[model samples]
Target: MKEEIQQQISDALGQLFDAVSKLQLAYPGKPFTPDGRLVGDIGEVIASLNYRITLNEGLTKHHDAVADDGRLVQIKTTFSDHLTFPVHHVPDYYIGIRLQADGSFEEIYNGPGQLIFDQLVNRKPTRTGLHGGLMSMLKRINKDVPDAERIPQR
Candidate 1:
């Protein structure tokens, strides 16, 4: 059940990524990559206010991203039904990507690309869900900031 849901999410997010890439390609000067630090979503959102964003692959490995604006973005992703944020210090920004069987993928930009997912059931999705999860994670990193104070202040 969980796997299925994950696949659905991955497919949807992949669609979203393609669309984002196309939009950026049309404009140029903007680069987009995937599978990057989920923490960079913040920088991506803030930077998107001006320069074009590329979906680089660094969005998943870490919790950080670099923006043309010279700012850092830290993105966080979750599959909570209530869309409630964690109380303790968490990622600078949060994104909730619901898993649906629909063929449509929507970015549904909230403030600074921050959004809370609502009413989603837990199910096993196909491998496609991995991709969607990947995008979600990357988006989170893009939104998150490199705060050593919270993670490892070392």
Candidate 2:
């Protein structure tokens, strides 16, 4: 089932990108990169399948999903090389996924949200009150997490 869904997503993305490319060719100086809600929605659905999370209902604050163990999880998805953290509340767990142009993804972080919080707490928040953390930092934090602490992936 997971594989089937993934393949479907891939096909859909392929079509979307093709259309974007055509638009780009028609208007050479314009940027056609898709971001914001669309990318976030894709990340949430895919992360739920990968980590066995139950997604929250529309646009919930702070956390997006709940782990089987009842932990509140903040799911972050990006095509860029970094993940952003909201300075308001620290989630029980955090999962960062980087979506590739090919519709594949890489888990950049999966562990206690405190690790990310601790790193960002001292940093200056942006105008949106979100702190950005680079992939290198996320990978480093992820490596230090013990297997026992990670939410098991499906």
Candidate 3:
């Protein structure tokens, strides 16, 4: 039963991949794919990215392949029209990936690609019986560590 649910989520993510691709193509890179890490960081905001990741398909390769190629992305699959996405600090943290122009589920990163899950997660969309819990969590852990202080400001 859980496997089926995962597949359903994966399939939904695939469709969201297509939908986001069409949206971008229609607007000529105006919008990008959704971020999954943001959702995982918070609540179920994963469904907000307008995309989804296959629990069995794009997991291993995403971390090893795409990210290895100088990319960091969170894959989310869903079956809704809401275009919410989470926010993050790292470059590879919340970047969105979708089916490329050539019908491939490859991940991409850039400006719009950098919207962390926090930015898209609906504040009041239903949470752990609390509001902004996920958002707050993300904000809490995302505190900036001063590299200069650690290695001498000079």
Candidate 4:
């Protein structure tokens, strides 16, 4: 990502956290952390910027973006320690990232979709169809991927 866009994302996330903080202060025990579609959307935007992928418009199924090499990519983002594969179709590529409190992010996995899919093993499918794996486990799996197999960052 460009330095300018990185700073912009940081600023926006700061504003969001501030607003959530105020909401929590008023509500006391209530939680206000951003998750679900918001985090997913942010991840998709960041992935597009960093990887130079073209995002598929209007909630296309299976994959979010397509790379310059014509590979369909599945981008997964989370605030927690897990990344979930909810789609049954394994994408051509997979990029997993975790959002931090300071608006920064950590890339968990970036490689062929089947590599991650193969690790699912005997995991039972959820009602939401999400098959989750720990970030640590994903990192270990990522180590086996040669750089040549990964989508290059812009």
On lDDT, the leading prediction is: 2
lDDT of 1 by residue, 46-141 (tens): 223322233345445322343434333343333222122322223333323322223222231222322222211232444433313344433454
lDDT of 2 at 32: 86
The lDDT for every candidate, in the order shown, is: 0.36, 0.87, 0.35, 0.84
| Candidate 4 local lDDT, 36-132, one digit each (tens) | 9999998888887788689999798899998898888889999888788764677788999998756678889899988877877567767877876
- After superposition of all CA atoms, the RMSD between model 1 and the true structure is 15.9
Which candidate model has the greater lDDT, 2 or 3? 2
Instruction: Score residue 113 of candidate 2 by CA lDDT.
Output: 90
- lDDT by residue (tens digit), candidate 2, 1-154: 9889989888988898899899999999997887788999999988987897899999998899998988889898898876877777788898989998677899999999998888777777678777775688889889999887788898
Pick the TM-score winner: 2
lDDT of 2 at 27: 100
lDDT of 4: 0.84
Give candidate 1 regions above 4 Å deviation.
Answer: 1-64, 74-84, 106-109, 112-154
* TM-score: model 1 vs. ground truth: 0.25
TM-scores of all predicted structures:
0.25, 0.93, 0.27, 0.91
Query: Using lDDT as the measure, what is the rank order of every candidate, best first?
Result: 2, 4, 1, 3
Error of 4 at 105 (Å): 1.6
Cα error of candidate 4 at position 56, Å: 1.4
- lDDT by residue for model 3 (1-154), tens: 5446545666765686789889988898576746445333221222222233222233343231233323334433222222224332223434223332222232222222223433435544443332222333333333442322111110
Order the numbered candidates by TM-score, best leading. 2, 4, 3, 1
For model 2, the stretches where C-alpha displacement exceeds 4 angstroms are none
